[model samples]
Target: MDCILHTERLTKEFKGFVAVDKVDLRVRRGDIHALIGPNGAGKTTCFNLLTKFLTPTSGRIVFNGHEITHDTPARIAERGVIRSFQISAVFPHMTVLENVRVALQKKLATSFHFWKPERSLDGLNARAIELLREVDLAPYAHLTTVELSYGRKRALEIATTLAMEPELMLLDEPTQGMGSEDVDRIRQLIKRVSAGRTILMVEHNMSVVSSIADTITVLARGATLAEGPYAEVSKNPSVIEAYMGSASVELVGAH
Candidate 1:
């Protein structure tokens, strides 16, 4: 399979410490690839490098066939690669419709047209409403963002990312802090939204990752320890010894 994103010997050094060791990563077109590791395992650092938020100390990052190791984050986003954070990112004071409208406005490059009547902008309201519906936030469209639950904020975040029409999305713990129902909802939303797009997510919950990930990469101590399909990686002795679960809990339930 052709990789939508590929990293070769990617490494990041902060002063004398290496946060991301020489790690190679591949996310194939239209695949949901999960990156899992303990805290300080370099998952976020890897994300930073991929998104060009941080320049790598060494190695190449290829996206859609071009070397993007030196590209700016905005330039990468223009190439249809986007990432959402573990923390909620939304204008809590804005109404749900207004929040999504802002995101759509950014993608449409209409931020400078503030004087224009928002309703008159072709497809603005329609598109925002569509995205809101896509993430199951339609009913809350007119509600203030602060009125929505934490999980709804996450859904809104995903909707905002979708407005960019990304080819690949890097999600950092998309379901963090969600209740079981909310987790399941977001999992379903991810599946629904990622139909034709590739997703690389850093997830610690075995059950969540197992349910959604097409492939899994395990990192420990800032290096890739193992990688494969969920079943294979779970059974790998190295993974079992290091990342089987919190305290080697039976992974069977995860699947």
Candidate 2:
């Protein structure tokens, strides 16, 4: 398999607590992978370690065959590893189109040049609108971000992430607080936009994971408990006990 990203003995520690312990993750190129576990299972910590948001105590991270364990978050982003936050991260006061344009500005080398005339950014509008259309937010492009529904706001966030043209997009909890309809919408949007890219997501929605993720890694107490497809990992005894503490409840399509 062609792995776009992988880690060897990736570990992180805080004082006496180990947040992430010796995880070996292999994310195949062009695949939608999921990291899942109960709360505090080190899913987010693993993400931080991969993105260089947090330093690893001991490990090596390779992206597209280059070791990036010591790279800064900016450096990682430059290599096309972009991450979205658990919370909605758009400019709430700005128009939806403007929010996406702001992200696109970085590609134009004008992200920090506020003194430039606003029309200097007009060249980015067409691309920004295309990103919005990819996430189904083009119809809401003229509206202020604050006026959007929560799910639409998340969709806009995806648009902004897309503006970065990420090779590996790490989405943290993409459907955390959405209703069923919104969850399905975001799920479909993710599927649609993943056509030519790789996605590694931290998600608790089992149905979403089962339907979309090509691979699933289950963590427990800062360690990998299982790694495989949803059907295989969901039925693993250790993963079942780690999640529900009982064999009766199935993990597949539970949400």
Candidate 3:
């Protein structure tokens, strides 16, 4: 398999307590890989390690054939690994078009001016509009992000992430806090955007994971307990055991 992101013995510790314990994770190019686990599973820590937000205590992270363990967050992003935060990280006061345009502006690396008009940026609006359309937010381009529904705001955030032109998009719960319909829309949007790019997301919505993930990794106690296609991992006794007494046992779409 051609892996765009691979980690070897990735470990993180805080005050002598292991958070991610020697995790070997591989995400193939063009795959919608999912990381799933119950609360306290250190999934967030593992994500931080991969994104270079938190340095690993030990081990290495390779992306697109380059070792990036020592890379800064901006450098990691420059390497085409972009992460969306758990919350919708849109500018509430800015229009949807302006929000996406801001991301494009960042990509151009111009001196960021907080008070500048969107039109003054020159050559950003057209690209931003295209991105908004890509995420189905074009129709709402003029609306301030604060006026958008939660789902629409999430969509806008994705449009902003897309503005970076990432080769690998690391989405932290792309569908979190969404209603059923919104979840379905985001799932379809993810499918659309993932056509030529890779996606590695931490998602708890099993239905979404089952519907979209090519591979799923189940983590417990800071280590991977099961890793495979959803069909195989869902039936693993240890996976079920780890989720025992948890809502995931019912919610997971392994069956």
Candidate 4:
């Protein structure tokens, strides 16, 4: 299988507590892979380790066949592994278009040239608008980000992430606090954006995961409990027990 990202026994510990146990995760290229588990299952910790926010206790992370376990977060991003929401990329005061324009600045290698005339950035507007359109935010391009609805803000975030030209996008809880309508929208948005890229998201919404994820890896107590398509993983006894029965029902229902 053409894996774009994978880990070999990746582990992390804090003050004698093993947060993320040895995890062997493999994400296929052009697939929407999900990392899911109950609260405190070390999902975020695994993401931190993957993005180099927290150093791993041991094991190696390989992306596109290169070892990135020890690389800095910036270096990982430079390598085209971009994690969204770990660092908020949005500027609330900026217009939606301007926000994406700022993210596009990195590609021009002029991100720090604040003194450049406003017209210097005019060249970025067209591409920025295209990205906004991709996430259905083009209509709000002239609005300040702070004025957008919560779901729209998240959509804007996706646009900014796209501006980075990521090969592998890591999304943390893309639908965490949304109503069902918003959830479905973002779920579809995620599906739409996954066309030519690989997405590895740590998601809690089983419905969203079932609908869009090509493969699911269920984590519990810092270790993988199950890994497969939702149809298969949802039936795993251990995964059901980890959710204490209720979520298993939800998983099956979602499937």
Tens digit of lDDT per residue, candidate 1, span 1-255? 799999999999999999999999988898999998767889988998999889999999999999999999999999999899988999989889888888888898888986887676657888999999999999999999999988899999999999888999899999898888988998999989889889999987778888889998888888999888998888776666565455456555441
Ranking by lDDT: 2, 4, 3, 1
Query: Model 4 Cα RMSD, Å?
Result: 1.8
Error of 2 at 102 (Å): 0.3
Task: Show model 3 residue runs off by greater than 4 Å.
Answer: 113-118, 245-255
lDDT of 3 by residue, 1-98 (tens): 99999999999999999989999999999999999987888888998998889999999999989999999999999999999989778899988888
Cα lDDT tens digits for candidate 4, 135-157: 99999999999998888888889
Per-residue error (Å), model 3, residue 157: 0.9
lDDT of 2: 0.93
Instruction: Please give the range of 10 consecutive residues that has the lowest summed lDDT in model 4.
Output: 246-255
Per-residue lDDT of candidate 2, residues 119-223 (tens digit): 988888899889998998889889999999999999998998999999999999999999999999999999999999999999999999999999999999999
Write down the TM-score of every candidate: 0.94, 0.98, 0.94, 0.96
| Candidate 4 positional error at 52, Å | 0.3
Model 1 compared with the native: what TM-score?
0.94
| lDDT against the true structure, each candidate | 0.88, 0.93, 0.89, 0.90
